[model samples]
Target: MTTAKTPAAASPDTPQPHPRRWAGLAVLSASLLLVVMDMTVLNVALPQLSADLRPDSVQLLWMVDIYALVVSGLLVTASALADRFGRRLVLLLGFTVFGLASLAVLWANSPAEVIAVRAALGVGGAMIMPSTLSMIRHLFTDPRERATALGIWATMAAFGGALGPIVGGALLEAFSWHAAFLVNVPVMLLAIVAGLFLLPETRNPRPGRWDLPGTVLSIVGMVALVYAIKHFGKDGPTDPQTWVPALVAAVTLSWFARRNLRRPDPMLELRLFRGPAFTAGVVTALAVSIALAATMLLLTQWMQLVQGYGPLETGLRTLPEAVGAAIASPLAPALAHRIGARTVLAGGLALSGLGLLVIWSWPGTLDYWAVAIALGMVGVGLGSLAIASAVIMAGAPPEKSGSAAAIEETSYEIGGALGVAVLGSVAAAFYRTHLTSEELAAEGVTGRAAHVAQESIGGAMDLAHEMGGAGARLAAQAREAFTGSLEWTSVAGGLLMLAAALLVWRLTPKDLDLNEVEH
Candidate 1:
């Protein structure tokens, strides 16, 4: 049974205490698996989904990103509410919402309807994500044990996300795009049932009054910032639509930060950024995700569109990443315990960056083995993400786990959105630049057909079927253009990660110990 003492009454130095913690972790991790898988499954299913829904380019982008945007905007509010009420209660509610939303996808015939369902799923995701981390903080008191648990937790995220493509691909072979969404229903139902029995209810006994203004500010500011970034990538920074939201985001976020600093009990604590380890961890998570998300986005397209692999084959090919991550993630904490977090963190980033470099320098031809090698390298580097989670959780007082979880998850959501926006834009630009209108015109492709071909490889492939011999040329050119874009994007992602590695190296204390810090 959980003690009824108010968190405010406990000393900051006090450690969390709980029974049946490992079993609780199993339940939490299983729930997380479904949450992450939901994100990845969509990536593999996008092509088939597009074929069914026939969404425009803008609508397609929205389908891909709206979930992350909504989840990012709502994370702070969800975390605060979880702390006020009960983590388990909020989590159970999230599972219900998520499962129902998954079922709703069956009726979603248009892109707009799918977007609405995704937004609802995002709300549920925001509720579940922070609670899992906060509960982990409460369940695992010993710092070393907490680190190990966090590593496994992070592993579940990586494995589930990577596994989504495989699962979706297999399902798509036997079923329609609907199967991807349908798969979530049964897993979520199982999670809900298991969680209710195995999970413990915990909350801050003396929670401060809910900060309504701060909550609104956080949501608006984050949403505006992400919107600006997304549009900036899509339509360039000079577009008035992009600049308007950019300005709002800057002003609102600045005000929100100041307001939080002044509050005795802020909804989302800005003070946490003062910790060197915490700051480094957040940055590492952001940079790594930016690189990883962009790479995965392009690679999935390459596998299906360029390589002509079936969905199942594409998914199976992506398993190298999961294998590499599973190998490294469980060992990261143990490695950090011995060598210091600074070394492990920096090394992981470097390894991942190197993997990107390999892909960036690849020859024009698609090489599955080489790509698998690169994926493995990236996975090894991603193992450090678990350490980042550990640092974020360890830096906060046990009473403030919810706040820490919100910040950590917010970084992930924002980083992923930014990655897809910026790098995805770069790819689009390269594709458009390399794909000349004159080249298509040479083959007697004009007007609407040429315009569609210019937009995306999928567009070119679809139009190719109708264009006879000319269509073959267009398809080949589109594939080559996409390959060039992938190479350039890889270069950008690799360099950014290397820079993050250096920054993390500088920020991490020389002899920082996780156990000491937590205690």
Candidate 2:
């Protein structure tokens, strides 16, 4: 009988620190930071963008969400493309497109034009993210060194996500919303130049041809699915418009998977899930992301609506979460080693659940310090999530690492969207059930006005401002209702995280060594 080769023995090259490695990391980090920052930077600029362009609500939603949608949709294909072509070449191309698209967005005069440019930016971002990680995999061949590198990469990603709102808010306060998009220009230019000089070309030795059909299928399926989910949450799941796209998405994705199962060189290798660690890691990552995404949305609203914080104040108040994550990033591997990844993940989830419970049980009187501490707990949980993802990718076969990374990212993007949609719907339903039309009318809301207010938490608050005494009463009621809903949501999130922890523990092998896996 033939013996299976081990990861360490299969591939003799183990990553060592080279002088140019840090430089390469710098380039990759900048690229990742830019892509992640773009994801949320426009949020602060949305009001300005709408005021300047006068877009409708749907258009506004598209502008806010389309970048993520497209990036998530195209990530699989982009990763495959990176493997087939050269990662460096792909990275540079993406940077160039992103820079040009940023300029286009800055100059856009109409909502349609802006949306178009944002979609283009998404395409560029998709190319950049997967390729950068794949390059990192090639550069850091040693599992331990790769883990360290991923920690830095993960830190940059988290920092960028945290800084986006603050940076965008500052830009908007000082200049215009256009500055938010335009800011990418210089960063992109610098990254492009640095990447060309410092980054090494990396590609698969036996890369398959670009699977165009699979690409189209994935894009259409993901876009349709996400759109359906968003519409379902905003409207109803039973709504024809919602179900129609969802049905189409399901069919297409199923077909895509079936096709991949038969193909020799599939765009995505479905067989990667044979490894229990990878499977458990993906599930843990997905569930944790869903909880975190939902928590972030609810917390933002709680700060602004309940605590009566301005945008800047809310941003500042949330800084502790980022700080906690930053402090924990470098320490993740150590913690993982000491406690084991399953235990660390379980503990992190437990901590996050406790944080959510704390917020849920907050007294009527606002306590900023308590809130900050809760947010910090969530941040620590997020750090664990990051570590889990790093472990998954590091544990994967090097040849299929790009696909593994793509799946990991896809889970996150999808989980985030699902969380916001599901939790937002729950909150909306509770808010409507708690508020009455009589109270709404007394607040200056009438006819379709009450209907619109019932549609969203923001709309409810806006309508409340119109109704004087009754509005004040209704606003208070709405706040209570929203908070109650959020409390339940937190419980659900906690349970989900707990379930994920158990799943990881059960599914992942106890003595599974990365050195034993096939490279």
Candidate 3:
């Protein structure tokens, strides 16, 4: 049995520590920080962006979402390309592309233009995300040292996610939504300069012939599935718009899985799922992302609109999650040792569910103190999943580290895409249910104004500010409707996290031990 490896170094005596491995790790962590931060900064940027761009609900969702969907489509192919060509070369090129794309946001005046910028950034992100993990696997060869390095990597990720909204909020306070993206430019430039100096060139010497068909299938199937999910959520299950792409996705993904299973040098190495621990890790990644992404997307808007907070204030309110994750990340290994890995793994999700339940319990108020408690609980829960990386990487053969990284990254990306599409749609649905066209018409706000008001809280608020007493009443009603929607959405997410916790508990071996994870 193999243990999943993470970003770490190899046996110092055998591989002589790669001399600059620690410095290389710093570069990797910095690059990872930017990628992860970019994923989240948009949460705080969305409302202002919506106000300026005036995107309808669907276009707004696409602008907020398509980044992850694009990343998901490209991750596997990018990982393979990195392995075949050169990891260092691919990573540096990723930095360049990422920087230039962020810079392009200067001219992204229209909704479609912004979405295109995000998609281009996703291309750069896919190239960076997996290559860093692959490099870390090669860097860290020793188990004990690898464990320590993993902690640092996980902490960096948590910290980056924590910083994103805050950093974006601070920038948005002074400037427009473009600053959220523009911030990435200098960071990527620095990464490129530092990477060129500190990082070592590495690649899989035996990368087989490029699996063009598999690559096409994976990318198209993933994009189709995500599109279907968003449409299914928005249009319901009966719509041909929803079902047609879904059918295509089902067939293409099934065929893709079959091809990977049959080929000795498969594009994805589907056999990784054969490891129970790997399966659990992948599932955790998916479920946690679904829960977290939706929570962040909704809560940020709620804070700004309902709570009457500025972006900076809203960002600060989210800090507790990071604090909780930081505290829990260090304690998770010890907890796993005392009880069991399975217990810690399942407990994390359960705790996060409890967080959602905590807020759901007081749905009428949506109090900050209660929300803070929930945030902390979810953060602690997030910390436990760091073990997931160890379990996944340790389970794969050394030669297949690149595949393992790709799979792990793919899970995170797709999970994020699904989270936004499915859960965001749920919130939108409930909001529309509470505030229908009839309700808006009753307020004497009809036509394009009523359509805009009913579509989203951001749009409604903007419309309200323009009108008089009627608009004030409309705004109040919109806030209440959105409150109800958030309540329902959070409970739905809570139940899902709870169900996933139970599933993880059952699927992982009862006697699973963390000590077994040392590669």
- Among the numbered candidates, top TM-score falls to 1
TM-score for all models, in order of appearance: 0.96, 0.91, 0.93
Per-residue lDDT over 1-519 for candidate 2, one digit per residue giving the tens place of the 0 to 100 score: 111122243244543434477678878988898787777676556656765787867887788668778887888888888888888888899999999999986568998899999999989988888787778787766565566667778777776777677677677777877888899999999998898888888777887777788889988998888888778777788899789999999998998999888888788877888878888878876887677676666766676677777556766777877887788776776677666666766677677767766766777744677678777887777666556666677566777778887887788788877777787677667677777777667766779987867655566676677666667766776777677777667767777777777787787777654323335
Show model 2 residue runs off by greater than 4 Å. 1-19, 47-54, 365-367, 461-478, 513-518
Per-residue lDDT over 1-519 for candidate 1, one digit per residue giving the tens place of the 0 to 100 score: 123223333346666455567778888998898899889899899999998999998999899878988998999999999999999999999989999999999899999999999999999999999999999998877776677778889989989888989999999999999889888788888888888888888898778788888888899999999889889888898999799999999998898899889988888887999989889889988998788787798999998999999889999998888988888898888789899999988888888898988887776665887789888898888876668889888789877899999999998888887898899898999999998999989877789888898888998888887777757888889999998888888889999999999999999887878755664
Model 3 deviation from native, Cα RMSD in Å:
3.3
Model 1: which ten-residue window has the lowest total lDDT?
1-10
CA lDDT of 206 in candidate 2?
82
Candidate 3 residue spans exceeding 4 A from truth: 1-16, 511-519
Candidates by TM-score, descending order: 1, 3, 2
- Return the top candidate by lDDT: 1
State how far residue 113 of model 3 sits from its true place (Å). Answer: 2.2
Worst 10 residues of 3 by lDDT: 1-10
Q: By TM-score, is 1 or 2 better? A: 1
Evaluated against the true structure, the overall lDDT of model 3 is: 0.82
Q: In candidate 1, which residue pairs get closer than 3 Å at backbone N, Cα or C atoms, i.e. clash?
A: none
Clashes of each: 0, 3, 18
